[model samples]
Target: MSNAASAQTTKTPGPGTYRASCHCGALRIEADFDPSAGTTRCNCTICTKTGWWGTIVRPGAFRLVSGEEVLGGFSRTGAGYSHFCKTCGIRVYGHGDIPELGGEFYSINLNCLDGVDLTGVPVDYLDGLHDTWEQLAAAPHVDPVTAAKRLSQTS
Candidate 1:
């Protein structure tokens, strides 16, 4: 292959767009992301109940394609806005800017994504239910021992 051809082949692909929806398909959302960018799982009450965390993206990266009218918002202690589908009661996404907890970011539900392969994608589990939940909720930071143990038990 020519040098130019090889260079082009080696270039990383731009963040690809993926579509997600509520359990009842009442709300559809589109997100552009590099799956290689990694994802997370939080153990906080709401997140634990929902089974998603660290899967958030920038607000600019997400778009509501339909069913905006069916979406509802919920927040606690003025932390963030948790959006859900009114018809199906599925938590779709969340966003907020809680000054008490530094700002907020768009939290997307990975389960909502259609056909993405998450194997070997590096999942970070956080203790969002504990007193130090806030301190361990960030992404790219996983408790090595805990994550390993959890994955081992599950696998």
Candidate 2:
């Protein structure tokens, strides 16, 4: 197993083995993660439109097993990269800076998860849509300006 796989062994759902596919199933991905670990829901425009339930994890924790050739990306003016299946248009995952986004870590779309039980995980919402950049920057442990700038660049 990879390090990402090993990290999951320490948590509940006993390190879930999850698979995510687009609406048409043309694009598929498999990941091993702990769904019980809490996720985030952002109030940003894109997130609201897509109804994203997000979880944060290191890049190593995720792997694209197949259909990479069919994947597509969407980025907003001030948001992280949103990846989806070009064939089915399913919003799969997102990568963004935390703290400034009212999170302590990066964000991932929980809907991408396949086998983890998310019923017990806590969720916190961030007012990304209306909050000022300065307020967002004031998050306890993150630099809002930097995050904002990064988000802008990606979008």
Candidate 3:
């Protein structure tokens, strides 16, 4: 088995296999990830703007089941590419090469996964804006909806 397969050995109690898609259903993927292990939220310009909530897996653990022809990619830093659906513009996943992460890694957007409830999933916060990949962010990230509510209350 590949390292990606081994890494998916179910460290947490959650669905191991997930079906993911873009908003328009033009891009689809099958991913093997243990969500209970945690999802990631990065505070980088791209991630913040895209509202990315991702789970990382090696290439073997991620499969583009369909709609490859409709997938569009964008890369701001050139380290990796964020993929979205050409029709609906919903980012489904991303892939990049990060030496610290054992080379190539795939970032599956947890938001795109079908039938997965993330209500209580542990969120790993990355301070990507500061390039502190090794350190967690001082403040946990709030989703856009929550942030907006907070903004309104303080105003």
Candidate 4:
């Protein structure tokens, strides 16, 4: 490739990268995604209680930068490995693979991200509580891609 092309590619990040951490910063996560992809607000019991917002990401694009020892996980839905910081007990992110959405995915918590504006992104209200995937798919505000992504998560 030409030097100019190489330089240009190097200068531009593939999508945008967001940094997230537990409340105490004990655990940090980094991910590359299109923030414009929008975020999700589920009415499910766990999500309602945590008030956590997330954007679906692929496993290969998401990462944990530190605090592996302090990280812990819970599986309320039996589909997602809901991880948190053991030190401060803040939900960081979740991951899982389901039969519905082809394969695995990462649900990166937007609330934990730094230097990102989530309000501008669209919001999808998922009826995870009721497992109404079809209804969620039909919602005008819902992004079909993200809906399908989250569908990979077990209930």
Task: Name the top TM-score candidate.
Answer: 3
How does candidate 2 score on lDDT?
A: 0.60
User: Between candidates 1 and 4, which one is better according to TM-score?
Assistant: 4
Q: What do the candidate models score in CA lDDT, each in turn?
A: 0.67, 0.60, 0.77, 0.73
Task: State the lDDT of candidate 2 residue by residue for 1-114, as single tens digits.
Answer: 432342222224435666665566666666656555655666778788987877666666666767788889877754567788888788886666555555433345666554
Q: Write candidate 4's Cα lDDT for 8-90 as tens digits.
A: 12222235777787778778888889766566778888888987877888888898898899989989768778999999988
- Stretches off by above 4 angstroms in model 2 are 1-14, 96-107, 131-155
Residue ranges of candidate 3 with Cα displaced over 4 Å: 1-15, 134-155
Cα deviation of 65, candidate 2, in Å:
1.2
Better of 1 and 4 by lDDT: 4
Count clashing residue pairs in model 3: 0
Which 10 residues in a row give candidate 2 its minimum summed lDDT? 133-142
**Which of the two, 2 or 4, has more TM-score?**
4
- Candidate 4: 10-residue stretch with minimal lDDT: 4-13
- What 10-residue stretch in candidate 3 is worst by lDDT? 2-11
| Clash totals for all candidate models | 2, 1, 0, 0
Q: Candidates' TM-scores?
A: 0.69, 0.63, 0.76, 0.74
What number of backbone clashes does candidate 1 have, counting pairs of residues 3 or more apart or in separate chains? 2
| Structure candidate 1, residue pairs in collision | 40-53, 44-128
Model 1 stretches with alpha carbons more than 4 Å out? 1-14, 98-104, 134-155
RMSD of each: 9.2, 13.4, 8.0, 11.6
**Tens digit per residue, CA lDDT, model 1, 1-155:** 33223221112323677777787777888877765576667676778777564466677888998889998988865667888899998887888775554465677786676545444455666665674544453344344565788899999
